[model samples]
Target: MASTVCGWCGDRTHMTMVTDLYQLPEGLWPTKGYSATPDRDLPVWMAAFRCPNENCQRLSIGWAPLHRAKMGPTKDLFLREQLNWEPTQIRRPAFPDVPKEIADTASEAHACLSIGAARGAVALARAVVEATAKAKGITMHGIAPKIAAMREQDIISPLTEQTSHQIRKDGNSIAHGDIGEELMSLDDAAAILEFMDALLDEVFQRPAKLTRLSERGTQQAPGGSADGATPVQGGADFSTPH
Candidate 1:
């Protein structure tokens, strides 16, 4: 079995437990030879894959037949194909601090890539950028103007501004039914989604986090030094109310 992707963390590898599964010991694997796909005529083996990533030792439960996934000559489409996974791999990471609308659009973009919709992913990524710009109070008429406003206000770096433009162009092309050599692969889609995440972090997530942290500190901080050695609120005793 070749490497597979973990839906939980998007870790791609030969996640198979033992390099060789044909040599299963007795009582190791229960095999009723269940056919998950009747037309394919191949029985799928379901198991928990061993994750090498210590930071994300997530037990990925997956079902696959003994055949390799379909791939281009040199690249993977990140297509679902015949594999069935528990968590479902999408390049989306958690964005708890972003606005609900923006987070939803960003997840939709990544979800498009998970099913091999590179063009759709690119298009939705453009939407995310525009939405982010608007959320930042840059309610301009067009993407170019909105992005320019963001750049002028230092809301986004020059590189990020460029990414926003390219995504906008590609999305425009798709809107007019002419993708025109833009986003030819899933890797391209992944890149756009990364840009989306960066945009969200820069425009929304970071600021929200900073404000939350500031408020929480003010609410929870003891009236003392940083270290716990200092007395808190003059060593107030709460056993009896004053």
Candidate 2:
């Protein structure tokens, strides 16, 4: 048995065989058994495996077929049905440098997107833009004006402003029940989320990284000479004066 990542425990483990291979009877086959080509032999297999992790010794049912490959034959497991698998809430990306409230709202928007809540996702995305603008001290009557103000202040790029405005418009359509605007689709919601990620990266993450690097350079430079060489501790410079 090859070592594989256990989905339950999130650990590397060798699967333990729990059941014998069971092949379906030929009478149940619909004209053809699992073979892709007539010349190749039919390959059908079913078995159960147990996770080796002591904490998560869950059983999983698997089905596969021996596939003919260009190099040789290979076993391909197409189905992995874990009876003990429990659905977990989707995790959202954490933006540590961003304000806690804004980050949490953005995370909720992402979680909504993951579960096919497109309208809710877009609504929360619009909220994120508003929250971001407010956090940046850009006070305006509407989202569009706030976005434009941000653009004028050079807080965000023109393209970012345009995208944020568009997202706001889309969310407004859903919120106001506009018959003219189509309901938010999954693709549209995903695109909005992507734009939000880019905006947050530009506004928070990149600047934080640059600030940290600047601080580090300043700290390191104190011990270095003007010529970019580190000064020896307790040693006098003996170089000829230029």
Best by TM-score: 1
Off by more than 4 A, model 2:
1-89, 179-182, 225-242
Task: Give per-residue CA lDDT, model 1, range 93-126, as digits (tens).
Answer: 5578877888888888877776556788888988
The candidate that wins on lDDT is 2
Q: What C-alpha lDDT do the candidate models reach, one value each?
A: 0.65, 0.66
Candidate 2: residue 84 lDDT (0-100): 21
| Residue-level lDDT tens digits of model 2 in 1-242 | 23344545554455676777776454433334464434234344566778888889987555544333423323223232221222223547687988999999898888776555677888888888888889999877888888888888888998888888888888888777773645565567878988888788777777786576555555666646564243343332335231
- Cα error, candidate 1, residue 188 (Å): 1.3
Residue pairs with backbone overlap in model 1? 3-13, 3-14
The root-mean-square deviation over C-alpha atoms between each candidate and the true structure, in angstroms, is 10.6, 13.7
Clashes of each: 2, 0
Q: Give the TM-score of candidate 1.
A: 0.58
